[model samples]
Target chain A: MDMRRLVGRNFARIRREQGLTQEQVEERSGLSQQYLSGLERGQRNPTVVTLFEVAQALGVTPVDLIQPDNVKMPRKS
Target chain B: MDMRRLVGRNFARIRREQGLTQEQVEERSGLSQQYLSGLERGQRNPTVVTLFEVAQALGVTPVDLIQPDNVKMPRKS
Candidate 1:
């Protein structure tokens, strides 16, 4: 279902929006940076709790992660 | 991430709370039953749009899908 792409698309954006690094999210979210990297690359499928953890660490809800945010600044490619 | 188990753990519960079946969710959510089955079984990782579709079909937000519901009815195994 292109789950990786879907999740990856928002992973980094949210991290950045919160001014976080992979390590920071990993530390706060209890998710490994490698896992966060994989999720950012659309290569991982996190569990429900992991989803909640990351969202919570980002100071948002899980819905905030899936739904498009109005912070329209483009990513630095 | 134990994604399959995590996703599967809640997939059916949510569908039941909404009183839907694999087929009904398939049609209404624009997802195939097979895919829905995989999702329910934690064998598939749906895209963001797919996640949105299922959440919309359930008349709940994506947060509703992942967050633990107050509904305490257990599954009939």
Candidate 2:
């Protein structure tokens, strides 16, 4: 999967897990609802600061928003 | 520490660990040296795509460039 789509999916998953509406996240993150929607749709490329702010609002680490859902565990040496 | 500074510090540390110079990263990532310097100084907020590109150039995961230096381990329940 593309990195943007991966980030979008992870972000949406985390936000839903937190029971946050787009309106609520917009209020908390100071990002517009349209922008948030676009981000969730994988149409926006957010700045790192924006990612941090949104992750903070969602009560998750920034890395969580970008990690792929199907990451494989490291193989034994 | 600020998130930007943490990212900058981690990025610089990783780049140095890989024995890569800004010029090398620039050539690989197609980002200007001036911008890379600003990022290293914590003065620029890179986009997610930019972060991915730079991380790829540095041979690191995007999350590794943003993790703080002093993370405490979670206590056992």
Kindly list the per-residue Cα lDDT of model 1 for residues B1-77, writing each as its tens digit. Answer: 35445556567887898788889988897888988888887776554455667877877665555554444888899
lDDT at A62, model 1: 63
lDDT per residue (tens digit) for residues A1-77 in model 1: 35456557777888898899899988898888888899888787665556667788888766566654444878899
TM-score of each: 0.53, 0.88
Candidate 1 achieves a global lDDT of 0.71
Question: lDDT, candidate 2, residue B54?
Answer: 86
Q: What are the per-residue Cα lDDT tens digits for candidate 2 across A1-77?
A: 36678778988899898999999999999999999998999998887888888899898888898886898989999
Off by over 4 Å in 1: A68-77, B1-77
lDDT for position A59 in model 2? 89
Writing each residue's lDDT as its tens digit, candidate 2 over B3-73 gives 67877888889999999999999999999989999899998888888888889999888888877778877
Off by over 4 Å in 2: A72-77, B72-77
Q: What is the C-alpha lDDT of each candidate?
A: 0.71, 0.86
For each model in turn, which proportion of the native inter-chain contacts is also found?
0.15, 0.79
Question: What TM-score does model 1 achieve against the real structure?
Answer: 0.53
Please list all clashing residue pairs in model 1, or write none if there are none.
A4-A42
- The Cα RMSD in angstroms, rounded to one decimal, for candidate 2 relative to the true structure is 4.7
Model 1, position B8: C-alpha lDDT score:
61
